[model samples]
Target chain A: MNEVMSLLKNHRSIRKYSDRPVGREQVEEIVAAAQMASSSSNVQAYSVIAVTEQAGKDKLAELCGNQGYISECPVFLVWCADLSRLKAAAERHLPAGAETYESSVENFIVATVDAALAAQNGAVAAESMGLGIVYIGGIRNRSQEVAELLSLPQLVYPVFGMCVGYPDQEPGLRPRLPLEAVLHWEGYDAERSESGVKAYDETMVKYLRERTGGMKDTPWSVLMAEKLAQPARLHMREFLQRRGFGLK
Target chain B: MNEVMSLLKNHRSIRKYSDRPVGREQVEEIVAAAQMASSSSNVQAYSVIAVTEQAGKDKLAELCGNQGYISECPVFLVWCADLSRLKAAAERHLPAGAETYESSVENFIVATVDAALAAQNGAVAAESMGLGIVYIGGIRNRSQEVAELLSLPQLVYPVFGMCVGYPDQEPGLRPRLPLEAVLHWEGYDAERSESGVKAYDETMVKYLRERTGGMKDTPWSVLMAEKLAQPARLHMREFLQRRGFGLK
Candidate 1:
């Protein structure tokens, strides 16, 4: 396998980080890499706020379901799906424009994809620099507060957060679905693909057992069932709507 | 600047690709890097189908608004926001379960984010390998046919497509919005961020004028207005709804 490929295959989420401060130069490079990501129609409807201040990071950690790493990491970045800039541009260019360019579901999708692409770029760049990063999606749990803390405009919403630093521990790569399960040749085959899921479940179970002392003994299927059975996950839609995304 | 940062800073969307096949090993590595991307709660609700066959690429290209590069590129990959696997997993684990899963908007978001994050990783990894790539959002222009062509099951939609190969031309680095335009200090600030747009518009106008001659001389704001003024983009919701994502 290629060296980069090996790094990718062995990648594990690093929640624990060394006590190191990421330099301004590295931060600029990471954000620049993020900006280079392809945008929908090149709109680039996303922005990232780097929170290096301990106070701001602590506040973000609180907003993101009290994830300790958010405050501990050398760099904390909030990836936002932003449309406010375009809205401002439109207003400045065409004062009579009646098209309410607030957060619509379509725009939300664009911004989210833009932010995700950029953040992924940043993550890859960080990894290449021998840094470890983990995405903090829990920021959406308290969307309103996050928006306030970040002072996001009406058309901007915090999609997620990420913590970057040197890894303090080496966690094993989490198992993924077998290629057959996820990859379809010509057309999608649900039944044909389910067979691959069985193998994936076994693989995951073995991985969990070996790594976490069999605490999560259930197969992948059962674990997913428990997750979906809850209603709290559905709260994100309401939060998005409240945050100005009329996902109509 | 780091080599990776330099590569990113110099990144350009390479629509014109050389007629060379991307090897299977490279494909696997890229896909593996994609899988390493963070997912919402580890759901990993997405899949990628590598299309190497010319006929298949032609069909996809036709379906995706007849983008010439889709057929021209040696390697084409369709990234699907997939929830069918989870639905099947649910059905297998809890037959006659009351809690329906497939027809939910939350699941769609999860799948889209998963697909986007993974595709971004794939893009960066491909870039790291000295390959050129471009994303095809035009795939969503004809979502139903794309779903049918990919044999996508209910609750599975094609979010986008990616074409990866060596570059045919060395395109310059595209300009982006100034950091101030997108990044908010605290809370949403429309008035404060407005100034940044002016600077960005000047930067982009100069870039457009220089890059593609005066023919493609539309300012970023004008291009965005044209995109939003049309109803063609609004059809995505209906298409997604028909594909079984009950956005209610």
Candidate 2:
């Protein structure tokens, strides 16, 4: 594989960061690369909030399940699925249709996908620059608080957060489901999927055992089964609705 | 910037592709890179379906609002926000809790984000290999039909499709919202956002006029205003619920 492909394949989440500060110029360049990502209908419905101040990082870290690395990392970014700008544009240029800009599930999906695409580009760019990065999805655990902390307006939701800085430690790449389990042919294949899952269970059982030094040697199936069965962020639907999304 | 950064910044939607076939080996490598992308809580709630047969592509293109390039591209891959495997895994390991794994909007968001991250990695890898790609969001316009065509199971929605091949055209990199418009410091800077939007509208007016060969010219605000005011896939809520998502 080439350098770019190698970069894509060797991704590992970084939770420990050195004291070295990430330059503002580097962050700008990375965000510029993120802006080049594809958007639904070119409606780049996403915004990123960069937090470098210790106070803000401290608050964000607390809000995001108290992830200390969020405060330790030199730069923390919150990627938001933002439709507020579109609403502003609509009101300014087409006042008659402003109210119609109310968010729907589809629009929410678009925004979420756009945010993820752009954020992934930012992650790749940061990693390519020899910086460490980790996605902070726990931010959703307190979505309302994170939004208030970020001063996000209606129609803008903090989808996830990221930490970027010089790596203080090296981590092994986390194993993923086998490609056969995740990639189908022209259609969904039930039998192939079942078999793939059985194989992947074995793979993950070994991986988790090794990664956790045999203290947590649970099979992947058991983990996912338990995780999926539990309600995650049960208040999310109401939270999104109150934030002017998916109400349609 | 390095090669990866350059590739990220120079991204352009490739709607035209040459007749050369994409090697299966090359695709597997690309997908291996894709599998390296981060997933929410390591759930990996997504899957990809690769369509290479002419007949399959034709049907997919038709399902995706008659996007001809989807059929013309040497490889078209559908990225799915899939929880079916999780459901299966849950059933096999915890049958009593299987039904509780029914989808919620938060889970849907996780799936969408996971799919986008994986798809972006695949796109970057494909571009690194001198191939081109364009994301097809229109697949959602007729999501049920598309799902049926792909034999997608419940809890597995086709989030988007991607067309990949050797590029037959070199389009200019599309203009994006100004960096200041999308990147906020600490929290959102409302004043800066308004000003940035004003500036970007001017930039997009020139870009749109030039890209369309002067046949049409409209400010970014105007286009976004009109598009955002209209209902897009208004039936999506019911559709998702029917597909075993957003039921919560």
Candidate 3:
């Protein structure tokens, strides 16, 4: 494989960071790379908040379920699904008779996906520059509080966060479902998928045991079930509604 | 910038493609790169169905609002937010007393974002190999029919489709919003964002006029207002509910 392909295939999430700081020039290049990712209809419906100060990072870390890495990293970035800018642009450029659009789940999905695509590019760029990075989905646990902390406006929601710095620890690549289970030819194949899952469960049991150093012997399926069994306790649906999204 | 960063920044949606057929080896490499993308909790809750058959692509083209490119591309990949394998895995691995998990909007969001992040890598990988790609969001326009055609099971919804092949058209790098507007320092900047939007509207007006050969002289903001004024007419919300998602 080529260098770019090699960089992508050797991906791993970085949770532990060293004291070394990430320079602004590096962050700039990373964000510029993010901006270059595809946007739906050129809407570019997303914004990023970069936090470098210790106090701000501490508060954000607290809001994001006390992920200490957020505070320790040289920079913490909150990727937001943003439609507020679109609304502002509409109000400024549209004629008097032009219809004002209300946010729908569709629009929300577009923004969320746009943010994700961009954030992934940012992650790839960070890793290419030899920086460690981890995505902080826990920010969604208190989405409202995060929005308040970041002074986010209506039609904007913090979807996820990230930590970037030099790596202090080397982590092994996490195992994923086998490609057979995840790749279908032309259509979904229930029988082929069932077999794939059976083989994968066994593979995962051994893999998890090795990765956790014999501490957690749980099966992947059970863990997923436990994690997702309860409806998200956080008020994400209401939170988005309050932010003027999902109105349709 | 490094080669990866350059590869990312030079992205442009390729609509027209030559008669060149993407080899299976190339597709495998792209998918492998996609699988290397980070997943939330390593759940890896997504699948990709590859379609190269012309008849299959034709039906999918009709279902996706008659996007001719879907049928024209050498490879059309349907990326799905999948939880069915998890369901089956949970049944097999969970303890007798373990509660059964139900799909929710939260789970759907995770899968959607996961699928998007992977698809972006696939796109990047494809571009690195001298191929081109364009994402198709219109698949959601007829989600039910698509599910039926693809034989998608419950808890597995098609998030979006992608067309990949050698480029026959050289589209310019589309203009994006000014970085000042999208990148906030620690918090959202209302005044700076307002100024950025004004400047961007002017840039977009000029861009759109030139791109459309002066036939469409509309500003970006005006077009956004017009396009999103009507709520997504498709019954995606109801469709997801029927498919056993959005329970929360």
Number of the predicted model whose TM-score against the real structure is largest:
2
For each candidate, what TM-score against the reference?
A: 0.93, 0.98, 0.96
Sorted on TM-score, highest at the top, how do the candidates line up? 2, 3, 1
Best by DockQ: 2
1 versus 2: better DockQ goes to: 2
Write the number of the candidate with greater lDDT, choosing between 2 and 3. 2
Q: Report the lDDT tens digits of candidate 1 across residue range B1-248.
A: 66656666777888997766688878887887888788888888888888888898999899889899989998888899887777777777776754865555567766888999999878877877879999998887778878877778887888889999989888777788776666554344566566777777788888888877875777788777656554445777787788778765
Q: Candidate 1's residue-wise lDDT over A1-248, tens digit each? A: 55555555666788999887788778777777788889988888888787888899999899888899998998888888877666765665656755754555577678888988888888877887889999888887787788878777677777778899999988877877777776665567787678988898899888888878877678888777666655444666777777677776
Count of backbone clashes, every candidate in sequence: 7, 0, 0
Q: How accurate locally, in lDDT, is each candidate?
A: 0.78, 0.88, 0.84
Instruction: Rank candidates, DockQ, best first.
Output: 2, 3, 1
Name the candidate, 1 or 3, with the larger DockQ value: 3
Query: Model 2: which docking level applies?
Result: medium
lDDT of 3 by residue, A1-248 (tens): 89999989888888888878888778778888899888888888899999998999999999888888898899999999998878876676665776665556678788999999999999988988999788888889888888888899999988889999999998877776777878888899988887777677788889878888878677666777677655563477778889988635
Give a tens-digit lDDT track for model 2, residues A31-76.
Answer: 9999999998888999999999999999999988888999899999
Docking class of 3: medium
True contacts kept of each: 0.48, 0.84, 0.63
